[model samples]
Target chain A: MDLSFVIFVEVLYGVASLVLISAGLAVVFGMMKVINLAHGEFMMMGGYATITAVGYGVNVFVAMLIIAPLVVGLIGLVVERLVIRHLYGRLIDTMLATWGLSLVFIGLATMIFGNTTTGISTPIPGFAFGGYQVNGYNFFIIIVSILLVITMYAILRGTRAGLIARGTMQHSDMASALGYSSDRIYMMTFFCGSALSGLAGAVLAPLVGLVPTSGGAYIAKAFITVIAGGPSLIAGLVSSATSFGLVSQFFTFTISPVIGEVALLIAAVILLRTMPKGITGRFFKGKL
Target chain B: MSRRASQDVTITLVVSAFLIWFLPLMISTYTLTVLVIYGMLGLSLGLIWGFGGILCFGQAAFFGLGAYTYAITAINIGESTLPMILAVLVPAVFAALLGAMMFYGRLTDVYLGVITLVVTLILFKFMNSTAGPQYAIGNARLGGFNGIPGFQTLNVPGDPSAYIWGDTYFYVCALALVIVFLLVTWLLRSSFGRIAVGIRENEVRMGLMGYNVAARKTMLFAIGAAIAGLAGALFANWGEIVTPNLFSLGQSAEIIIWCIVGGLGTRFGPIVGAAGLAYLKFMLGQQSMIDNTLIMGLILVLFVLFLPRGLVPAIETLLNSIIGHKKRKPKPHRMRRARHG
Candidate 1:
């Protein structure tokens, strides 16, 4: 019974982390229809921001929760005004331009960070749970993700700003006809998406050693999660993350971590093969 | 044949002949061979991406598969001929399977790109972790991060005793590239290639017109994979080593940059792009003061923003404006049709 409880926590943790990793990409790609290939880089910059802030003697929570997201969001705002703004409707061109941006980010990071791994220890300590030790940080991540989902749902569903953003995303001309500037909406949405990515990176930095190219490791996973989630933003993100998280964790506990990743990718391929429209696209229909 | 067609053939032949003769003297066989291999790789992508309109993010996966397949087969059989053939065949077959799944599933372009990227990254991750002795397939060990080296290199067909390397190998690579280039040009002019391009322009219309768009796309994708495999086989011979880095994101990104910078939809553009960029990368590798990736990234951004039509198309436009009408002039309508064709 104790081991099962531990396993349950692990699974939840897995699902939450997947959600966190892909939240920014979900906003950018799902709503905006812009493939921000630099999504992972934005997260990487967030991680660096958190580390730098913490080094400058700020509170760890403040560094992670505030500074990192602000820095990365500002960067995103600049990227939006410059590159993404120009290649709005052209899908392939946007992908190429963003890919170039990703490379540029990686190059800049390598130059600044000296191409070496840097990381901080987890603030929370491990505690005993029956025979196995449970990471206290896991609980922190699970809480953060729960709160994130609630906040996103509440804001997007409840606020007029969210409605305007959604309206602009669906039909910019219609949104513009109603007195809201679609350009400003797009710019703000991009900023939020980028900030979310940064937050995810900052929160997760304690778990892994950070490298300039660490973004590459997360790009595929985040893309798979967001793509597999389908159209309905929050519902799709939660459901797919839950399913993939369970599948990957199950395999990880049963076999190995690498096989777990392989299984997740294979599952995604099979899922895409079966449901080309994604889970939310078929089932949720019109839920945000 | 049309006068324009014959003229194009004559120009291609003359250029190939001149390059084959002159390039060896201008640069070392080592650098030239690498350039030729990269050119072939770029052409593979150019064929599918430019003509077929499939922007695969993992051409490196097939390239890596070809290299690994050749290395393993060569080590086991101790013959270069079968391994080289297997290299091409394996990636082609793999691509056919992958392409069938994506195309038949009717996934969107973004999903297709994401799937291909994931698959290649999976291969990269898997290959990097296989450092144990149990990872061996027959006599060849999957050397993990250190990669597989010390395999039998390319030799004359059916004769293990005769080895091919240096200048002879460069000549063979250049010949293969020329043959592939000419074949691709010929294929594009055929009815099947025209249908493929038609599907690329409008898949719904092609489907309505009774052409099997999915099957055509899969076939084109397989052909591209085959060409990339051929290049990978040559690369293994040139470098005499195959690492997991062959399947890296950077390698895949570089191939796309080559196509974009050279000019998409043109046969010669990819070769010129690959050769020029790869040579630049080689030069950059010799110095460590400035980051090579920074320069590459800046170039990709600049090219995409300013030179979207690429170097070849831009130059063609320039030539048309400057001296096109004065020399052997043609009607503007014919020129437009030729451009589309």
Candidate 2:
């Protein structure tokens, strides 16, 4: 029973982290179709922001929930104005440009952080749970992801601004005809997406050793989850993350973490092969 | 052929001849050999991306596979000849199989890029995890991150005792590059190549015209992989080692940047780009203050923003304007079409 509980928590933690890492991409790539290749770098910068803020003696939660997101969102706004705005409709050009941006971010991070791994201790500690010791941080991540999903659903589904953003994503010209500034909508959406990415990185910074190129590790997994999720942003993100998280955790419990990663990638390939349009495209038709 | 076509061919031949005869005296043979290998790698990508319009993000996967295959096969067979052939064949077959999946599935561009990048990362991770003694094929050990070293380098065909190194090795690599260049140039002039380019321009139109778009794309991808594999094999001999770094994201990005900087539509542009950038990277490695990737990223962004036509095309435009070449000055749209074609 204890082992099963441990396994269950591990699985949930895996799924939650996947969701956390891929949420920003789900918004940017899934809704906007902008293909921000620098999504991972944005997360990396967020971690750096939180770390820097914490080093300056700020409260961890404030640094994570507020400072990181604001900084990254502002950065995203600048990028949107300077680079992404110019290449909105051109998908391939946007990809190349963002890839260049990712490289620039990595270089800048290396210059600032000196290319060494730096990370903070988890604020939450491990505690005895039955016969097994569980990291309390695991539960924190699970709760955060649950809250994130609910918040995303509430905002995107409940709010008027959300409706306008969705409308702009579907048909910017139509949204413009309806008196919404699609450009402003796009700018705001990108900022939110970038902020979400920052929050994720800040939240997860304590768990993983941070490096300039740490973004590369998350990029493939996030891309796979988002791509595998398909058309409906929330449903696809939730469903795909749950499935991949389960698959990877299952393998991790059985074999090793490396094999777990390999399994996730293989599963993604198989998933893409069978359902090229993604899980939401097949099952959750017309869902948000 | 048109008079323009004949002139282009003559220029290519003259350039190749000039490089083969004069370049060995100008630079160290080792650096020249490495440059030529990179040139070949760039050409492979140029063929698929520039002409076939398949923006593969993992050309390094095939390159690394080729290098590994050659190292393993050469170690087991104790001969370089069959291993070299296997190097090309392995990546080609792998690409053909991979291409079939992507093209036949009718995956869009972004998905294609993601899948290729994922595949390359998979190869990298797998290769890195093969440090254990159990990861052996025949007598060759998959030497994990340390990579396979001390493999028998390239040799005279049928005579393994006669090792080809130094000046002769440089000449051989240069000759191979020249041959690949000419073959690619010839291939582009063929009906199949023209159809491939057409598919790039408008896939639906090519499919509607009764051409096998998927099959053509798969063939072109396989050819590109073969060339990349050959470059990898030569690279293994040049460095006398093969590492998982060959399949790294950085390596893959560098190849794409080379194509973009060199000029995508033209055959000769990638070679120049690869040689030039690789040399710059080599120089940057000697310095500690400046980061190579920073410079590369800046260059990519600036070029995409202002000089999307790339170095060769921009230079050509400048020269045309300077010399007042009337024949070259067609209507703008027609000129663009003619240049790409």
Candidate 3:
């Protein structure tokens, strides 16, 4: 029972973090079709923000939940204005441009923090679950991911802003015809996407050592999740993340973590080849 | 061809020939040979990306594959020719398989880029983890992070013991670079090359016009991979060591930067871009005044934003304006259908 329960938590933890890392990309790339290659870098920045804030004696949760998002969101706003605004529909160009942005972020981070690995200890201590020692922090990540999903769902589904954002994403010209400014919507959406990325990075910072190019590690997984999720926003993200996360963790538990990573990639390749449009592209068609 | 076009070609040929024959005497063998390697790598990428419009982000995978193949084969076979052939063949086959999956599966451009990048990262990760004794390919021990070293290098085709090194190696590489350049130039002017370029401009349109779009793209990709493999083979011999860093994201990014900076889709662009950027990088390494990564990032951002046409096309436009259309200028492929007032 303890082993199964531990396995369950590990799988959930994997899924949750996958959801967290890919959420921002779902909005920015999936909705906006912007193909932001610098997404991992944004997450990196978020991690840095939380760390720096914690270093200055801010509460870890507060630094992660509020300050990191705000800092990264603001940076996103600046980036959107200066760079992304110019390459709205040019998908390939945006990829190249944001790739450059990612490099810049990594470089700047390296310059400021040096190329050393740094991290803070998990705020929550381990607790015994029956005979096994369970990481109490895993529960925190699970809860955070759940809350994030709810927030994104509520805002994108229930709110007026959400409707406008959806409308803008689906048909910017049509939305513009209806008296909504596409530029404002795009900027605000990018800001939110960036904030979400920041939040994901900040929340996960304690789990792993942070380095300047740490973003590169996250990029492939995030992209795989988002792309494999396909056209549907929330549904696709959830489904693909669930599947990939499970497969990776399964391999991790059974054989080794390195094999798990390889399994995830192989799964992606097979998944992409079979269903070019993605899991959501096939199953959750017309879903939000 | 017109008089001006033939004249331009002859002049270019003469200049390149002179540079190949003369420059090796003046420059250090190390610098010239390394430049040759980048030039070859850039040439392959330039063909695929510039002409074929397949913007691969993981081209270093082929380069690394070729190097590894050569290293392993040369070690076992105790000869250069077979390993050299394998070096090119290995990457070409890998590329063909990968490209068929990507292009035939009708993957969108974005996903294609993502998938290629992931493949590269996978190769890097897998290679890095192969430090254990279990990971052996025949006679060559696949050294993980430490990489394989002291592999048999290039020599006379018939003789195994007669090894080529230093200036002789440099000259061979220089000659190879020039030959590849000329070969690429000839290929670009061929009917098949036109089809590849046309596909880049409009894939569906070409598909509709009864062309085997995917097959052509796969061919182009394979050819590009073969050249990159050759470059990698040379690089392994030049560096006398092969590390997993050869397949790194940084290396991939550098390849892309070279193609972009030199001039994507142009014959001479990749060579110039690779040579120029590699030199700039070497210089930056020697200096401590500025951060190299930061500058590279800045260059990427700035170049994309302001100089998307890259150095070559930008210069062409500038020269055209200066001469005020005194001669009939050849328009780059991007200019649509000769728009006249």
State every prediction's TM-score relative to the real structure: 0.97, 0.96, 0.96
Q: Report the C-alpha lDDT of model 3 over A1-288, residue by residue, as the tens digit.
A: 889999999999999999999999999987688878899999999999999999999999999999999999999999999998998877877777898899999989988999899999999999998999999999999999999999989999999999999999899999999999999999999999999999999998999899999998888899999989999999999999999999999999999999899999989988998998889889979989
Interface RMSD of 2: 4.8
In CAPRI terms, model 1 is classed as acceptable
Model 1, span A1-288: residue lDDT tens: 889999999999999999999999999887778878888899899999999999999999999999999999999999999888987777777778888889999889988888999998899999999999999999999999999999999988899998888888788999999999898988899999999999999999999899988988788888888888898899999989998999999999999998898889889988888887788878888999
Error of 2 at B95 (Å): 0.5
How far residue A52's Cα lies from its native spot in candidate 3, in Å, is: 1.2
| lDDT value, candidate 2, whole model | 0.89
The collision pairs in model 2 are: none
Segments of candidate 2 deviating more than 4 angstroms: B2-7, B24-26, B328-341
Q: Is candidate 1 or 3 superior in DockQ?
A: 3
lDDT of 3 by residue, B95-157 (tens): 999999999998757677778888998899899999999999989999999999988889999
Q: In TM-score terms, which candidate is top? A: 1
What docking grade applies to model 3?
A: acceptable
Task: Name the regions of candidate 1 deviating beyond 4 angstroms.
Answer: B2-4, B327-341
Return the clash pairs for model 3, or none: B50-B265
